[model samples]
Target: MSLLNLAWHSLWARRGTALLSLLTIALSVALLLGVENLRTQAKSSFASTISGTDLIVGARSGPTQLLLYSVFRIGNATNNISWDSYQQITQQPTVKWAIPISLGDSHRGYRVMGTTNSFFEHYQYANKQPLRFAQGRALENTYDVVLGAEVARKLQYHLGDKIVVAHGLAAVSFVNHEHYPFVVSGILQPTGTPVDRSVITSLAGIEAIHLPPQQQAYSEQQLTPSSITAMMLGTQSKLQIFSLQRQINEYKGEALLAILPGVALQELWGILSIAESALLAVSICVVITGLMSMLSTLMVSLKERRREMAILRSVGAKPRHIFGLLLLEALLLSVLGALLGLLSMYLILAAAKPLLLSQFGFYLVLTWPSLQQLYLLLAVVIVGFIAGVLPAWRAYRYSLSDGMSIRI
Candidate 1:
């Protein structure tokens, strides 16, 4: 028989034990690869969400907190910087562009941000990639609103549709901006960032929505926005970032804070690193257990195959040939199991892509494995080869003893 056919038959000869071992290996491979892929993607997506930005200026607090609130929308801004300070910083010779952000409102659970038209022109994500509109232009009027890709898909919002805003970021809002309703003017393309899960409007629109306390007397007055949550500043020169930040920090006019976006992002990742590492460690332990199970099952099956080895030896089969047979069986099993596991992972990720994208703006790119993943697969294959060595060694030892008369 051909070597391939021989290996196939040998594996099928112990089909019950072999199938169980194969399954164990498949499970382990899937968990290891799946966890690694997710971890790598999450880190990359988080880091790439804001690129080409020099610094993020916000209220005085931890850098991580500033990034979390400004870029990721993970938490509320601790305080609001006055609109006057925002204007002062933007007029500097070193300042190129500034996008002011006003938060503290929501449609359903998605955040509502009021920013300038410069945001669409200047904001970048996924490695300095500019925002692209799937439909219509950026919001210009006080009542025009733009929906992010995820926000549109999840809430089933359409261009020209009118939606009311909640006073606070609440999923089930009771207090509403009943006076000023927003018309969906545009929908943004997927950016794989928090922007995809947000609603964007003009800073003026934000100003018009929340009127000053006295305007509440004319409760029927048209939208008149006043305050905002935070602002994003862009600079003309890279070297001027620190000096500008210092200027905002020392502003005696108002209590404020200015942070560098890159620094804040690093600190944010550092704070989240602990939880992520813990999850990976747990997944690794599970994978190790699965691998051990496969190894033990393979080793135990050798007892029943001892008689088969003896019969082959009695027929004058060489020790090396018998060892090759055992090794070939393991190689085939590992390859088949690995292939199946990879296929399953791909299918699962495919099905979950839309949901994940719309819910968190975390797009799972279904591309070929990166170099790191390739290296991981290579390590798995090497481990499989080593796993087969012991079984092959046992067969070799048996063949050396049995000399053409032994059937036991």
Candidate 2:
């Protein structure tokens, strides 16, 4: 029989041990590839959270902090900008439109955002895709509020449901605005962004809720918003972005800050780069451990297969043939492990997609293996071949010395 066939039968004879090694490599590969996939998808999801807006204008603070609060609702604003400043910036000739944001409220842990109808009209995500309503329409009355897809699902809220907002951004706030409860006017479609976890309402609704029971009777026109947390501005021309940003930053009315959302998002990602690198390093170590396991299995198997190699050598098999046999076996194992790893990754991603989207707003998309994954698989095969070389060489030397020794 050929060396290739002989190696195949030899592997089958020790299927139990060989299968264990294969599974080890497979699990390691799956973890490595899974990390890469999550990192890529997370970056993409983050970058697509907000689009079309030229700048995020907020209280003078760290760009990343402003981004966290304004765009992601991750943190509180250091300070709020005056309503007068928001009006002045929006009325600029270069400005096409602006959406004011008022934060510092929550309902069952989901952030409550106070903005205008322009928010639903101008806000964009995932390559400038406009927000679509899953049910009902944008806030039409002073007490109307909108619920994000996740918010509605988690809280079991529907249109016309009266929900009270809390004063603080906590899941169980002691201060609740039960006196001025809001009726759910709309529910937005899922966007796989921070918006999915937010509760949206009109600016007037925000003011009315915060007002005391006596002042709650004030008209929407009379109660001008005193201050807002942030504003997303869309410039008339892309060329005027820097000019507008600079003007907003150096405004005389308030100490405001303007940041390019994309730049701040990149900076935020850079801050997390160390964590990403650590994950990759850990995965690499696991992969190396798996390769070592494969090497150990092959080295241990060599002792029992010495007489088998000598028999092959007696049948005119060259030392190179014995070397190729062992090397090919290792390569086959690695290749099979890599294949199984990819299959398992897909299965895990498929099963977890719904849970991930619901809980973390992460939409994991399944696609064919990426080029990076291909390179990783190639690297595993190379490592496997190298791992086999020592045992293959040891067998070759034994075969040469044993000559025609057939005693098993």
Candidate 3:
């Protein structure tokens, strides 16, 4: 029989033990590749959360903090900007549009955002993709509210449902605006961004809910907004962004800060890169452990196969042939495990995608393995060959007498 056929038959004889080692390697590879896939896709998701807008203007504070509050909805603003300042900025010749945001209230744990029609009109994400309505229309009246996809789905709310707003941004609040309940007029489509988790309403709607019972009866035009939490600015020219940002920062009237969304996002990711590295390190360790287990199994099997090796030598097989056969067996196992690992990763991701989208608004795109993953597979094979060397050498050193005699 040929060397390849001999190696194949030998592996088949020990298929039970070989299968366990293959499974261990397979699971380790799956975990390693899964971590890499999530890290890459998550960074892409976060960077594309808010796009098309030139700058995020907010109360003077740390750039990271402002990004967290305005874009991610993770925290509250330190201060509010005067409506007069908002008007002044919007009226500038370089400015094309401004969407004012007033945040402070919540509806059943989800944040309530107070903004104008421009928010739905000009806001863009994932390469300037416009927001689409899954149902109903934008806020036409002060009390007409809009619901995000996640907000509606989680609360099981539909259009025309009356919902009360809370005074604070908490899941459960004692102070509720029972008298000024809002009617859900619109529901936005899922964008896999923070927008999916927000409750949108008109600026007048926000002011009305917070006003005294007597003031709630006033028309939207009569109830002027005193301050806004932040503003998303779109400039006429990309070149003017730095000039506009500098002007907003140096305004003499009130404390304000302007940040380029891309820059702030990069800085935020830099802080998170450390955690990504640690995850990769742990995965690498797991893969090494799996390889070691495969090596141990192969070494133990060498003892049982000594008689077979002796028979092959009697038929004129060289010691190097014995070495090559053991090496080839290890390579076959590693290659099979890597392929199985990739398959397992894709299946798990497909199953978890919907739950992740609904619960966290994170969209994980399914794609083929990246070049890095290919490199990792290649590394596994190389390591497997190296791991087989010790056992192969032991087989090579065995004399014909060692396996030929049966000790009683």
Most accurate candidate by TM-score: 2
TM-score ranking, high to low: 2, 3, 1
Tell me model 3's lDDT, rounded to 2 decimals. 0.90
lDDT of each: 0.78, 0.90, 0.90
Candidate 2 per-residue lDDT, tens place, 1-408, comes to: 776788788789889999999999999999999988998889899899999989999999899999999999988898999888888889999999999999989998989999999999999998999999999999899889999999999889999999999988879999999999999999999999999899998888888877778763687565578999999999999999999999988998878999999999899999999999999999989999998999999999887888888878877988889889999889888888888988888888899899998889887899888898899889988998899899889888877777788445
Model 1: worst 10 consecutive residues (lDDT sum)? 217-226
Instruction: For model 2, give the 10-residue run with minimal summed lDDT.
Output: 215-224
- State the displacement of the C-alpha of residue 292, model 2, in Å, after optimal TM-score superposition: 0.7
lDDT of 3 at 385: 78
lDDT of 3 by residue, 1-408 (tens): 877787778888889998998999999999999999999899999999999999999999989999999889889899999999999989999999999999999998999999999999999998889999999999898899999999999899999999999989889999999999999999999898999999998998888877888653686565679999999999999999999999999999899999999999999999999999999999999999999999999889777778878877777788888889888888888898889988998988899999999888998999989999899988987997798888888888773346564332
Candidate 1: count of backbone clashes, pairs at least 3 residues apart or interchain = 6
The per-prediction tally of clashing pairs is 6, 0, 0
lDDT tens per residue, model 1, 176-234: 88788899999999888998988998766766667753464432224433445667778
Of the two candidates 1 and 3, the one with more favorable lDDT, higher being better, is: 3
- Would you estimate the TM-scores of all the predictions? 0.90, 0.98, 0.96
